[model samples]
Target: MERISRKAAEARVLDLDGREHPLRSLWASRAAVLLFVRHFGCREQAVRLYREKGTIRALGAELVIIGNTVPCFARAFREDLAITTPIYVDPSMASYRLLDIRRLREALLSGGALKHKLSALCGGFRRVQTRLDRSQLGGVLVVRQDGAVVYRHLSEGADDHPAIEEILAALAPRTSDEAQASL
Candidate 1:
C-alpha cells in the first residue's frame, strides 16, 4: 500500500496505435473513465466495459482501457474484442503505480473475492499467471474536465470492480438540456 498522489494530470499513455498522449487528452467529454486492467487477458470486466461503452458515451464521457502489458498484447486484445473504446499499453505500469493500483495477496479473504473466483472458474477462465504482473489488480477513476478525479475505485482482487450502475451513477451528466431550460 504505497502512497499515490493524484498525478494523472501529468501521466501519459501510449495508445494502441503507438501514439503517445497525456492521459487527460482522452477527456474529450464531460469526463473520462480511466480503467486499469491487470493484464491483457482478463476479460470479465473488459466485457462489461465493452457493453457499457455506449452508456458512458451517452453521459458525455469516453472510456479508455489501459493494461499493464506490451503494445502487442494491447493491440491484440482490442482487436479480438472489437473494442471501440481506446486502449493503451503501459509495460512500465507508470499509470498504475501513480494511481495507487497495486497487488493484493489476501484477495481470497476479501469480500466477494471467493465468489468472483468461482464465477471466473465456472466461466471457463483460468487464472494462468502472466509473465507480466498478473496480480497487479484493477481500478477505475473518473476524471473530470479539470483533471480532478471525482471518483476512484481500486480493486481488492482480479474480480473487484465498481458496479456498472455505480459507475454510471457517478458519470451521469450533472445537467441535461431539459434541466438547463429551467435555469
Candidate 2:
C-alpha cells in the first residue's frame, strides 16, 4: 500500500442526494470529521456510533462517511434513527484505497482467508471482513484549513478510538486575546 500522508486535503465530496459539496463550503466549519466505514452497507452503525456518543453536536464538525457502505448503514439507521450527517458513497473504493484502508489483499493471504470466504458464502462476510480491515477500524483526525493534520489517533483494534469530547477539546480554538493573556 502506498503511504498516505497524514494530511487532510481540500477534496470535493458528494452528499447522499448526489449533490456536490466541498469541505470549504460548510457552516461554522471549525473542523471536519471523516468516518471511513467498511463494507457496502454499514451506514447504520456509523450513525448510531455518532449519535450514542453525541459526536455531531459535541464536535461541531461536519460528519462525513467516506466509503461504499451506505446501503447497510442507510437501512439500519433509516428504520430506527434520524441521521443528520451526510453520507458519501465511494463505490469505487477510491477514497478507501487512497486512505490505505483496503484490507482485501492482506486478508486473502492470511490464515483467516478460508474463514472469511466461507463467511462471504453464508452472507456473513462483512463481520469477518471488517476484522481484517484494520485501517478503517476507527480514528479521530483533526484537520486545519491549511490542509494539515493537527491531530490523529489511528487505532488497529476495534473500539479503540478517541471520545467525542476529546476530539472537541483538540479542535477548540483559542481567541487572540486568550493567546495573548496566556503569554
Candidate 3:
C-alpha cells in the first residue's frame, strides 16, 4: 500500500497512437490497475491481464497495460489479444525507472521464466521476439484518482506478477483521512 511519489506520478508515457500522457492521466479520474509488462511479446503476461480485465472492471477499476517497447508492438499485441483495455508504452522507461522496477538479466534462465513460457504455450499463446529488452522486469500498481497509490508490486524477476485478488482488494474504498495522508 505504498504511495507513488510526485515524480513517478508525473512521468510521461505514450499511447498506441504515439500520443504522450502523464502517468497520472491514466488514473486521474478513476481507479486504475497499471500492468507493466516485460515486453509486448510476453504473451503470458498479456493473457493473464486480459483474463483479469473483467473482474477488475467489476470492482470499479480500469486496466491499463504499459509496455517498454515501440507503439507498433503494443498495437499488434492489442489486436492479437483482442484487448479492449487501453495500452501504452514507455520507450524511455522513465516511469519504470522512477518506480524502481527491476532489471535482472540473469533471470532469463530461471525456473520461473521456464514455467511462464510453458504456461503461455498451454494457454495457446505463442510469439517469437527479437531485439527487445528481456531483462527489464515489470510490476503492478493500483492508483486512485487523487494520486493515492493503494497498491504497488515490484517484480523480483521477469516471471513475477501480483495476484489479481490482491489488486482487487486494494481498490476497496478508503476513508477520507487515509486517502488524504497518501497525498
Candidate 4:
C-alpha cells in the first residue's frame, strides 16, 4: 500500500445509513484503524478483526470498517461477529478507488487463500451471497489524529493481512511492551 499524505487522504465516505461524512473525521480526534473490508461476508478478515478488537481499542484507536455492502448486510455482519466496531457503507466504492485498491487474482489461487477458506469454513463463517461486489479489494489504513496515514496495507491476496504487532506498534510505543509481555 502506498502512503497517503494528509493532503491526499481527504475524501468523503458514506456511513451504514447512507449519510455522508468527511473520511478524516474518523481519525480527526484520535488515531483510527480504517479497515476497508472486501465484503462483510469475508470471514477471514472479520474473524481477524474480531480477535484483535480489544488490542486495537486498548491502543486508543478507533476501529472503523468500510465496505461496498449495503446497510442491512453491514448490520447483520456486525451482529454476527458480535463486534461494536463502527461500520460504514461505500456503495460506489469511492474510498476504494481513491485509495488505489485493486483486485488480486493470486488471492484465489494461493496457499494463503486455501488456508483462509478452510479456516473460515471450520470457524463457522459461511460466505453469504448478498449481491455485493466480491471482486473489489480491501485494505487497511492507520491514520493519526492529524490525518496522516501512519500505516497502510493493501491486500496482496484473499487472506493477506498486516502483522498485528506492526499495527499496534504504529498506534503507540506500548504495543511492543504489550506484545513482549504476552509472550
> Model 4 clash tally?
0
Ranking by lDDT: 3, 4, 1, 2
Evaluated at residue 114, the lDDT of candidate 2 is 53
TM-score of each: 0.80, 0.54, 0.88, 0.82
Compared with the true structure, all predictions reach lDDT values of 0.75, 0.48, 0.84, 0.76
Q: By TM-score, how accurate is candidate 4?
A: 0.82
- The list of candidate 4 runs beyond 4 A from truth reads 1-8, 105-111, 174-183
Alpha carbon lDDT at 27, candidate 2:
27
lDDT of 3 by residue, 1-183 (tens): 466788988899999899999998999777899999888887676677678888888778899999999898888888877898989999999999999998986848789978877877787878657336888999988887777678888899766888777887887766899778867
Better of 2 and 4 by lDDT: 4
lDDT score of residue 107 within candidate 3: 43
Provide the lowest-lDDT 10-residue window in model 4. Answer: 1-10
Pick by TM-score: which candidate is best?
A: 3
State the displacement of the C-alpha of residue 178, model 2, in Å, after optimal TM-score superposition: 11
Model 2 lDDT tens row, 1-183: 122343323344455655655444432255566666654233333544466345454655566555554344433434444565655654444555445443432433254545434544465324422212333444445555444454555544333445656666655676899657745
Q: lDDT for model 1, on a 0 to 1 scale? A: 0.75
136: Cα error in model 1, Å: 0.8
RMSD each, Å: 4.9, 7.4, 2.7, 4.8
